[model samples]
Target: MSSTGIEIERAAGFVKNETPQIVTSRFDVEDSHTLVGYLATGGYEGIRKALTQTPAEVHGEIRDATVLGRGGAGFPAGVKWGFMPPDVFPRYLVVNGDESEPGTYKDRLLMELDPHQLIEGCLIASYAVGLSQCFLYVRGEMALAQERIATALNEAYAAGYVGRNILGTDFSLDIILHWGAGAYVVGEETALIESLEGNRGMPRLKPPYFPAAIGLYGKPTIVNNVETLANLPWIANNGAEEYRKIGTETSPGTRMVAVSGHVKRPGVYEIINGTTTFRQLLFDEEYCGGMLEGRTLKAFVPGGGSAPWFLPDQLDLPFEASEVGPAGSMLGSGAIMVMDDTTDIPKAAHSLTRFYAHESCGKCVPCREGGTWLERILGRIIDGHGTTRDLAMLLEVGETICPGDFPHASSERLGLDAQRFPYQMTTICFVGPSAFAPIHSALTLFPEEFAERVRDVTDEELAASAVGAVPVELKGVAAQ
Candidate 1:
C-alpha cells in the first residue's frame, strides 16, 4: 500500500497475459534511486549500448518502437524528435516532470523511485537528438522527487555518466534540475517552455511558437514527458520488436496507470496498453479490487480530471486511446479516477471546476473570465442557491469556451443528446475545456442530482430571460 492508502499492484493475468513492467521495473528494488543500486539492476547500460550506434540509428529505433508520449497528448516521441529542423545547432531537450493533473502521480513515482533510469533515458535522447543541454523540470510540490533527481545528477556527474565525453564517446551533455511554483497550466509544452525561460508560465500560441520549431531561447526544442523519455532505456536494451510484442499493435508496450478514488486498491499499475478494460481495472482483484464493498460504480474520470466522465456503460471498453477517444473520452495522462454510487455529482463537478478556475493563468480571456463564471454558477447550485437558469448558463459558458457541439455522457433521462469526444476549443490550451468538462459530464450523466439541488423556475421565466443575465435572486448569489 502507498502512503495514501492506495495499494500498488503489478499487472497480472487480468487480461490473460503477463504484462511487462517497463518504467516501474526497478521501483520495488531497494536503493534503486542510487547509482550503485541502479548499476546492480543493469542501469546506464542503455546509454552504453546507444553509444555503440550512430545518432540516426538510435533515433530510428525509437521511431520504429512507436513510444507514445505518456504525459497527455499521446504523440509519438520519435516523430516529435524528427521535427527538429536539421542543421539547427544548440538544440535543447526539456523533460516535463510537472505532473500536476489531478489524480496523476505516475511521473512522480518514476522520478522519486528510479532517478537513474530517467537520467539514462535523457542521455540516450540527448545523444540521439544531438541536444546541447537537458532540463528536467519537476513540479514544485514534488520535493522528494526533486531531491532524488538532484542526488542522481550529482552521482552521475561524478561517475562520468553525465557531462564531458560520456563513456569515452564524443557525446557530452549536462542535465539541470529545475522545479516550478506549482502552476497547473505549466504542464503544457509551450507553457512549460515559457516558465523555463523565467516567464509567467502562460501557453504560447501555435503556428509561430510550436516548441519543435521556435522554442526556448528562440531555438529548436523538444519537450517530452518524463514517462515518455523513461521508456528509452528499455527500448535501447530490448529490440523494438520485442517491446512491440507486449501490448496491442496500435499501443504497444506497457503503460503506468495511476488509479484513485473509491476503489479498494488504488495505486499505480503497469498494465499492457490497449488490452485492459475499465471493468478489469476497477473490479479485477489485482487492480482496484472492485468498488468499495457494496457500493457500485457510478462514474469515473477516464483520463485525469480534464477528460469527460464515463459511466458504467464504458466499463467494458478497452483502455486504449483509439477506443476511448471514439467513446467520448481519452486515456489522457493515464490517470483513472473512480467514483462510486454514493458520490455526489453536483459537488464533484463543482470541485473540479474550482480547480481549473483557480489555476487559470488569465492569459486567454475565455479561460480567465469564463472559467470563473462557470465555477461560481456550479458552486451556487451546490450550495442550494441556484435557479433553473443557472443550468442553461453553465452550458452556455461551456459553449463559449468550447464552441460547437460539446461532448457529454448520454442524457437519456432528459431526452438531451451529446456528440462524441474531442470537442472544439476556442482557447489556446485545454484549460478552458477542462474547466467545463465536469459541468458538461455531470449535467449530462446525472441531471437529476443537479435538478434536485436547484430551484426550478417556470418555463416562461426561463424562456423570457437570456442566459448569463443575472436576476435579482442570483445577483447576491453571484456576488458571493
Candidate 2:
C-alpha cells in the first residue's frame, strides 16, 4: 500500500519493460552539453542522415511519425512545418524555450543539459522545412541554460555542424540564440515573434497573424517548442516507425514530464507518452515514488498551472491528450503537480490566480481586468471575509473569460455535472481562461473549503478586506 492508500500495482504493465529516453538520453552523461561529448554520444547523426535525404523525404518521415508538439497546445509538429507557403523564401524557424509555465521545467533541463541535442534537432527541423534561419528564444531567467546553448552554438559553428554547407553537404543553415526577457506571455508563438522583432511581447490575434502564414518580418515562419524540436533528431535517426512503437498510436514516442509538489521524488522524467498513467507517474517508484510521507492525494494539476485540476479519482487516466482531455483537463506541457489532503484549497487557488494576474501582459481586457479581479476575490475568501455570494461571483467572472459551462469536475455542492475541457473562451488567448482554471476547479471540486472560509461579511467589510475593491461587473454578480 502507498501513502494514498492505493495499491502499488507494480506487476501491471503500467511500467514499460524498457523506458524510451528520447531527448533525455544524454542528460545523465557528465559533459553531454559539450560539443565533443555530444558528438561521442551520436548527437549530430540525425542531421547527418537528414542532409542525405531530400527535404520532402525528411518532412515525410516526421509527418508520418505524427510527433505531437511537446509544447502546451499538442499540435502535430510535421503538419506545422507543411503550413509554410509553397516556394516561399526566407522561411524562419523560431524555437520557443521561454518555459515560464508554472510546474513546467522540462524544457529548461533540455536546454541546460543537452544543448547540442537541441541544436541538432534545430538543424534537422530547419533542413526538413527549408528554413533559411533559426532563432532559439530562451527564457532570460535561465542564465545557465542560455550560457550552455550559446557556448554550444559557437562550438557547433566551428565544427561545421551549423552555418553553410553543414557536414560538407549542399544544405546550409544558421542558428541564432536569442534570450527572452522572462515574460510569461511571450511563451505564446506570435508574442515571442513580437519580442524577437523588439516589440512588446503580446499575442497577435489569429487569422490575420498566424505565425506559419504571416510570422516574423511578415514572412512564413514555424514556431516550435524547445522539447518539440528536441524530438526531431531522435525521429530522424531512428525512423518514424521505430518512434511509433514506443508510445500509443496517436501520441507517438516518449515525453519529458516534470513532476513536482508533495512528491517524494520530484524531477523531470521521460516516460512513454500514452502508456504512463497519472497513478503510475505519481505512485510508481520509478517516477514520482508516490506522495510525501503522511500526505494522502487530494488533487493534482494534470498539466501546468493553467490546466483544470483533477481529483484523486482521475489518477488512473493515462498521460495522453485523448484520455485526459475528455476527463476535463489536459496533459499540457507534460507537467504533473500533486497536492496533498492538507492543502488549503482556497489559498492554493488564490496563489495560481495571483500568478496569472501578475503576468497578464495587459493586452486583452478580459485577462488584464478579469484575471486580477478573480485573484482579489480568491484572496478575500482566503483572508476569511467571503460570503456565499462571493463563490457565485467566482464562477460568473470565470464565465466572462470562458463563456458557457466552465470546464469543471463534477460537483455535488453546485449540483453540476462534469463539464469537458477546451472550454469556450471569450478572450483572445488562454491567459484569461488560465486565471479561471484554478478558481473553477477549486470551487467545483471542493466547495466546502470556500464555504468554511467565508462569513456573512457586509459589503463594506468585503471591500475593506480585499486588496483591490471588487470590480463593478463582479459587484453586480455578488449583489445577485
Candidate 3:
C-alpha cells in the first residue's frame, strides 16, 4: 500500500490515512481545474480504456469491486447498477451531489479538488450502467462548484472524454450538471431524481417503484453518491483486489469521514473502512482537541443527520454502517459529529429538529406537520420552559416523524399529545427520544443544571449552552 506521503496533521481531511492517491490524485496539479493540468496527470485513461470494452465488461468490473453507496445506506453499488434495465430511451447515472447532510462535505472536497476525476468516474459509471447520459444534481448553494464542474465537462468534451464517440471508440456518453433548489430530502435517491426532473424533492414510495425499475422520466435509472462514483476509475484501473487490500472483508476500500465536534483538529479524513474506531477520531483531533476541558463527552451524530446519536460508552464501536446499526445507530455518510462535555443535549436536539422542520418541503403531511411540532416542543424544552409532562409530549412528537416498523398512520403521525386534557396521549418525531437523551441525562448527570432550569432560576444558572467555536466551511471542506 502506498503510505499517504504527506505529513499527518493533528486534524482535518475526511478519513485519516486516506487512500494515498486513490481519490486525491492531483493535489499538486498546477491549476488542477484546468484541462491542461488534468491531462498532465493520468486523467482520461480510465474513460479511454473503458470505451474500448463492452458495457457489460465495465459493469462486471464494478460489480466485482463491491463498492457500497457512500451516501449512508451502504447499498451495494454494483447491485444497483445491475438493476438498470436494458432500455435506450434515456438511462441516467444520476450523481447524488446534494451535500446537505450535516457532516458530509467529502463530495464537495472531491468536486473542488479534482473535478476531472469525478467526471471520469461519471463517464465510467454511465458506460457501466448503459447510460448515454448522466446528471450531477448538485446542491443549489454550490454555485462555484457548479461552474467548476461545467468547465470540466466542457474540457472533457473538447478532449473527447464526453460527447459522441468518446476517445476514438464506438461508445458515447454525456454528463450534465443539474442544480438543486436545496433540500435534505433530495439526498434520498428518488427525491433527488424528482428534484432533477423539476419537482419538489420528496422520496417516492418503493416496490413497483425502484429507481432502477422506473426512475426520472419514468425510465430505469441508477443514482450513486459522488464519492462512491469517484472511486470507480481507481477500482476499474487498479482492479478489485487492489482496492480490497486496505479495508475489511465486507466494507472494502477507504471511507471518507467528515469529522466535526470536540477534537484537536476537525476536518475530513479518508480512512480504510473499519480501520479506525470512534475513540481515536474524537479524542485525537488536535484542531477541536477532545471535548473542551471540563466538559465530558455527550452523544455523537454518526452518519448523516438522521442517524441516531452514539454516547461516549459506544466509543469502541467500529466505524461502518453494518457495525454501527447493531449498536442502535447508523454510520451514515461517514460524518462523525462529536459532542463535547458541556453541550446541552436537549438544546442540540432542538436545533437539528428545527433544521429538519424548515427543510421538510411539505410535500407530505406527516414530515411537514410532524417536523414543525417536533421543533416547537423540543425548542421550548431547551429554553428551560418545559414541564416533565412536556418530556412525554416530546417523545410523542418524535414518534410522529419516525413511526416505527413503517405503518401509514405512523409515517403520517401528526397527532397531538392531548387536545382534551392532562390524562391523554401525545404525538411527535425522533426529537422525543432525542430530547430525553440530553434532558434525562442532564437530570441525572448534571442534576443541578436541570434543577436550575426547572426552578426558573436566572439565565446564569441554566446550563451555559455548551459554548464553543463551530468550524467554518472554506471553499469545499469544513475548517477549524
Best by TM-score: 1
TM accuracy, model 2: 0.91
**RMSD values, in order shown:** 3.9, 5.8, 11.6
Candidate achieving higher lDDT, 1 or 3: 1
Q: TM-scores of all models? A: 0.92, 0.91, 0.81
Candidate 1 least-lDDT 10 residues: 9-18
lDDT for model 2, please.
0.86
What tens digits encode model 2's per-residue C-alpha lDDT throughout 378-466?
Answer: 88888877788788888888888888877765544456666777888877777889999999898888878887887765677567558
Q: Which ten residues in a row have the lowest lDDT in candidate 3?
A: 416-425
Rank ordering of all candidates by TM-score, starting from the highest: 1, 2, 3
**Shift of residue 412 alpha carbon in model 3, Å:** 35
Model 2 worst lDDT run, 10 consecutive residues: 8-17
Leading candidate by lDDT: 1
Encode model 3's per-residue lDDT on 1-480: one tens digit a residue. 116332334533533343455776665454887778877777777877777778788888888788988987788799888777666557878898888876677888778778888888898888877786889888888887888899998888887878888777777877888888867778878888888888887777656445887998988888899999889888877877888776787888887777776654677777668767777767755223466556677667766565556566567777765666655556768887777766676666666666767777666565677667767866676687765555565556545544442111000122311111011112222222332232333332333444444433334323332343332223235532
Ranking by lDDT: 1, 2, 3
